[model samples]
Target chain A: MYRYDEFDRKFLAERVAQYRDQVRRRLAGQLSEDEFRSLRLMNGLYLQLHAYMLRISIPYGTLSSAQLRGLAEVARRWDKGYGHFTTRQNIQFNWIKLEETPDILAHLAAVQLHGIQTSGNSFRNITTDPFAGVAGDEIEDPRPYCEIVRQWAALHPEFSFLPRKFKIAINAADADRAAVKIHDLGLYLRRSDRGEIGFAVTVGGGLGRTPILAQTVRDFVPRRELLAYISACLRVYNQYGRRDNLFKSRIKILVQALGIEKMRQEVEDEYAAMGDEREALALPDEAVAAMQAQFAPPAYADAAGDDAELAQAAASEPDFARWIERNTRPHKQAGHASVVISLKPVGRPTGDCSASQMRTVADLADELSFGEVRVTHDQNLVLPHVRKSALYDLWLRLGAGDLATPNIGLASDIIACPGLDYCGLATARSIPVAQALAVHLAGREAAIGPLQIKISGCINACGHHHVGHIGILGLEKNGAESYQITVGGSDGEQAALGGIIGPAVAAHEITATVDRLIDAYLRLRRDGEQFPDTYRRVGLAPFKEALYVAR
Target chain B: MDDPTFKLVTGNRLRDGAVVYFASAGIWTPRIDDARLVEEKDGAALLAEAQAGPPPHPAVGPALIDAVRDGDRVVPATLREKIRASGPTVAYRAA
Candidate 1:
């Protein structure tokens, strides 16, 4: 949606040149590993377990079909013919070569894509609801504001190096699909009594060793002052956030120690000190209108045959009916629906889209949904503006590519991190655990109803196990893989951290343990009750009690 | 607490970041099978020597990891190292 202008093109070109030189220096022995590490990290080139992993940003999880094709080209040419979509709504190429990154980045620049701020202690990719502009409940499109922040934070000298990596998510919809609460800074658009748009900003909510929900600091800040207000919040954190201990360095830890009131006061004091600079940083009305124009709502055709065609298709193929029920959502446009192409096929690694699949989705985006794609934070791709009449055709094409898995909110739609399999920091394996759970739960997932299961290889919580209704955190215990389960975690507007239930189960027992937990939920749940609702009704006691029951 | 009788020095190849094991004659090989096994006595010394080289080493982040000879093959002791020696345990990218 938001195409890069000439200025953006020039800015990206210069950055690529710098990265190319840094990579060249490293390869030629002009720079040592220690010296080159930070530079490489800044460019999102990580030296993972088996090979280098290059994380490319999809700003606010939005992409054009052409950009999707460009990513496919990078995966096919330089990587292992596939890319892993991550929890941050970005894609990571796991098999990248250290020397080939510069060439790959240059290729990405051709399609207005780059890996900047996808890693390091910098402002990471700005994420938002996959159903951003299209969601029926949205107050306004948040993508324009997300784009604004992306430009402001990219390589900002003041925030280039924070205590640790920063994450920000903005949501305009009632449904918190972006997991806005579990970020360094979270923004929700609100309207004042005068009907002017403003932000309900939250600070210091994150998940790592210490997970905390973001506390609302500024209930409302006017639209024009958005940038200056956020700049002040970051300035406070930058000035006083911890730098001594690596584990205790996230803004959440700072917020925890200082308390929310003190932290709010500090940020407010910083805002007051900013004074005239705040006026200088104000977002103008013209700028807002310009951004809105770029993300303008697509022209919807008043197709008369949509309902009849959908009914006929559903009657013809029950599988298509199941898919429509699971993978599609209501749209703001009367004749349209937002389609989620499930990346988590049963028995496959979650979020690993093949080169051909990327190419196929890119083509499908153009053919069906206005040539745009949105990646979900839960490792799925969204065709955000699909016509209701085109739904059947979209399903047929997606099915052919094996992208039509009808398990959107079901147990099999797992979210997992690249754990010991790919990450050097992981103590235990996560991908295998996710695979096993997906395979075990596939046939009966429909019966289980809407559920969220997330897995992380370690406590870094990349898989966002902290928010899963059934969260599984993998750890190494006595030289063997062990998994700890949590219950009642949610990442929606009513955000929460999960509670651990008893001892960590051995690797072999994980699937069965999860099965028992689900069975417990089924037994305890009332009609139409989801996993989190059931968990809340019947606390962790019943789940814990059921976990180690005689099998 | 981490006393394994046998060990092998491992790192990633500089150019490609491929998992490599320290072999004989100051060479690094992608295959763990070709890795030269060092006893606990010589493991620290070999690791130090490999890590102390001048600018631009053949491999980076060299460290000693426990490994034992499983019949004719030099297999890594831990699952993490085993996964590193081979590729990811899960079949990804293809599907």
Candidate 2:
């Protein structure tokens, strides 16, 4: 885990103090709503449907046991006794009081955490693969580069007020676990033919009112020039990105309007201009090395013998076996595995973890993993490293806390935003939809296999519905809540936006509609193909016919 | 066309950000039943009063919501308004 230095600590302390004064002024009625709006957003505070929401950044989805415990404390003391982990790898407290926000921020700062750059038209939280370092397929850990980007983007004067909120994602593994293609800037770390480390940069991909898959801008830029190249891209966007229209402000719109070739040329021109002073902008090898050193792999005991015991335990316990199959992934280490704690259990709102659950996970991290936890893009938690031998014990403990549902990538693992329930921008409710779908699919998840069901309250795509195998977008039609279903979207290695299947369905009928779609998939799928694969091969005709046709 | 005459004014309290409705006696209450119902002719005046509450009142986006009176209680006509008035339709633990 990366430890904050004295400089980081001091920076966060000053930021907390500044926000404290801002909150005080706002509460005293000295700052009008208009005046305090941007200021509060700068501190990652927002006035939502029912209450103030505080979005706290978990940089690159990485968290230490101490930080997790602090979050639990905040949840218990300041707001409600729970927090919602968002798709951006950040956690939001929905019931924050405006007056107590500063104190909560202070508490977070004490744990070397802050909500800086979590909102506004500034750089949002930097997200990466949850299995950053431990994944066997990873070429290099992306967290160090994520950290580098986080520091560079923090309070960047030039890019503070961009055309729209900018999001950056980095992925080092072959699988693209970070959902890179949907980010404003997607960096794929790779090794060149000559074994030099570099990045494949993609730009202009995002989901909101308009969803577009990012196009590659550069195939290879050396690691040292990563910052310069990113700065060049931002400069181009800052110069020409739309500011007149809120809906057309994202860089994806600009990229679409200007074309990728033109966009690439413009970025290349700016990059070349920066290259003239490359020594100043390019991160030095020593600096990169220093950052890399902070994310060095934790010491691992040589325990290849533990796998035999793990196998024996899995054979004896069916539930443990199922959990191992679904919730655990192969770690880079020989005797260790990365375990996913499912937050989307049936009958519960997806991504919500109570204070007690948070503390339990923290304790589990201390005892099992290396005192580290990772929040995934799918609103799940990850223990990046756990001994294969200790899987049974960990699974049992997780079960006790309602965290072990054995449905990591299954249908029950739904991604849902707090829709009309709490979000002011939502046109319809999402949590209820997700809950209903989870219950409907609970018994048939194993049969359906790995399917990503993402629900968004509005077109903002906070739940990443655009990339789901079955995307449910909630909208208001005529005075009632309705849903629009999309099919075949994915945010994996081959990212694609889902196509809307049919007209809007009533909220109450969504589960049955989804059931019809799944039944179509089941009927059409050849062999054991997943939903996305089957949908890709067969197209949406079968599902569309099944859905729209009379019973 | 939907009747826009029957309405109620609502906004979140500035101090705690709680969802509140403009009620009788110029007070904001967390209950929809406490909201003062107004006809289309009186909606503008009721909204003005709600927005012109004493200092440290609701901070953002105070507006009149189309509603209807059911027995002694006022019910929001639109789904969005209904959700705003009674919290989420689903079970949510965030008090």
- Leading candidate by DockQ: 1
Q: Whole-model lDDT, candidate 1?
A: 0.90
Give the per-residue lDDT digits (tens) of candidate 1, residues A1-551: 68889999998999999999998888888999999998988888999999999999999999999999999999899988999999999999998898899999999999998888888888999999999999989999999999888889989999998988899999998888889999999999998899999999999999977889999999999999999999999998898888998988899988999999999999999999998999999999999999999999887778656778787888888999999999999888776889999999998999999999999999999988889899999999999888888898889899999999999989999999999999988989988898899999998999889999999999899999989999999999888998998989999988778999888989899888888888888999999888788877888898888865744
Model 1: per-residue Cα lDDT at residue A157: 92
The parts of candidate 1 lying over 4 Å away from their true place are A548-551, B1-4, B52-54
lDDT of 2 by residue, A269-354 (tens): 98888756666778888998999999999898897998999999999999999999999999999999999999987979999998
Off by over 4 Å in 2: B1-5, B24-26, B93-95
What local lDDT does model 1 show for residue A456? 94
Candidate 2 residues B1-95, lDDT tens each? 64344878888888889888888645888998888888888889988887885555554667888887777777888777777777767664442
| i-RMSD values for every candidate model | 1.3, 2.4
Query: For candidate 1 chain A, which ten residues in a row score worst on lDDT?
Result: A300-309
Candidate 2 residue pairs in backbone clash: none
Candidate 2: docking tier: medium
